[model samples]
Target: MTSVSSKKCNKEEYSFVYGDEAVSYEVVRKPAVEGLSHQKSQRKIAIKVHPSCEVVVIAPEDTEREDIHKAMMKRAKWIYDALKEFRGHLEHVQPKQYVSGEMQFYLGRRYVLKVVEDADALPSVKMTRGKLLVTLTRFNDGKTSMVRTLVSRWYKARAERIFHERLSELVPHATWVEGIPSFRVLPMTKQWGSCSAKGSLMLNPHLIKAPKECIDYVILHELCHIAEHNHSEKFWRLLTSVMPNWKEVKSRLDGLAELYLNE
Candidate 1:
């Protein structure tokens, strides 16, 4: 195990501690906002990576050296890539894929796309059996930009349907949110789905590639956000009340990054 204490021990900054047996990392940092040093705990377990430019690991006090080395090696690639990519976020903000014959999602179901052109009619989407029929009666310039419009439109339709179904089943006790009005899908690289207190949700289409159980878990997770905005202890209690086996589902979902990581 490891222990961390803030002092000029070796004239170098020691901001982390790791437990060899615990398989977790703890980080130490001085409070950015002033004046709470002695009153509150300065060290905290770092379970997630910050969206910053450095690779920082925080471990519990009294952690072992061997475990700390293993943990660092386990997250070595993530640390390296995150630090490298943190500085180049501006260069990575390109539009989501709108390539022809790309698979899309509709209500957690897979859809093969079919795009058509019409000048007088606006873009519309319909699903039959296993196929997604997209009719865009507008421009056919053969440019990817023109197709992006229709693709974006299709995502909205799918997001709306899924959000409605999930809200109805998951939050039937509430009448405050009413119905989903403006939901959309995006190729979000950060999260699988997100919900707003304003009765809207943004989903990543890649969720369809996950297991059905994981999809349900994601839907239920977002639906619970309607009642609790932040992921507090109260939120977890509420989630557990609705989903007793959520831990198992979460374990499955955590490993699903490979499906969308390549995209």
Candidate 2:
């Protein structure tokens, strides 16, 4: 049995061939469980395809090379499907220039970002008449930067308010969850939300642009983590118990990650 230090990752990146494509992936080892343990065959290997189209294999630190290899092989098909879907998201979303007529999303609806430059107008971002109006007074020097800043701040504020409300609304459903768990909005390129072992949550502000249902899904997913902590069978069961149609919602969200995450 090997003990992995929390400060360091002892495993290196690994790759395996799938059909004609040589897929590459990274392995993130979790610390071995203390005292009681499951059999090697029963040991869980959690495979996740992130919004960034990165494949991550998470297994207990003491897992053997052969077990990890077998788990990867078994999940090869799912990995490929997830990769293709996420890749399509990236390929389909048009790059943003932060200019007028650019498309943006708010609560599952698409809106055109109309950059309204006015030397006398107060700098602000407001949704009006099906358009995201970014009014600016200091637009001459850094027009694009200003638009980005104002929009990002607006999204953060919305996320803070919306996430807390949804968390409160959904907390009662997760009977195992104690009170309201603490959460914060911190933008990340790779994940929509993550939970610490201590039960605090870190959510992406980009999630604010997604539909309210999708937002609820992300929040509920994290709330499940409060009890399960790992992506094991228990975790999935807990998640499914609350959001029976979570798989559908997750797919829908993944399909739009490219658009929602675009700067």
Question: Of the candidates shown, which would achieve the greatest lDDT relative to the real structure?
Answer: 2
Query: Model 1: per-residue lDDT, tens digit, 120-224?
Result: 776666676676666666645654565665555555555556555765566553433456435567677778889877757777766655655676677767767
Candidate closest to the true structure, highest TM-score: 2
Candidate 1 local lDDT, residue 1: 33
For model 1, the stretches where C-alpha displacement exceeds 4 angstroms are 1-100, 116-123, 136-142, 173-189, 192-216, 222-230, 251-263
- Per-residue lDDT over 1-263 for candidate 2, one digit per residue giving the tens place of the 0 to 100 score: 12121233665577777777767777777886666466852478888888787878888877886777787888888888888878876776886888999888998998999998788889999999999999988668789888999999999998999999999999999999889999889999979999999999999999999999999999999989889988899999999999999998997898788789888
User: How does each model score on TM-score?
Assistant: 0.45, 0.67
lDDT of 2 at 36: 49
Which stretch of 10 consecutive residues in model 2 shows the poorest summed lDDT? 1-10
Ten-residue stretch with the least lDDT total in model 1? 15-24
Clashes of each: 18, 0
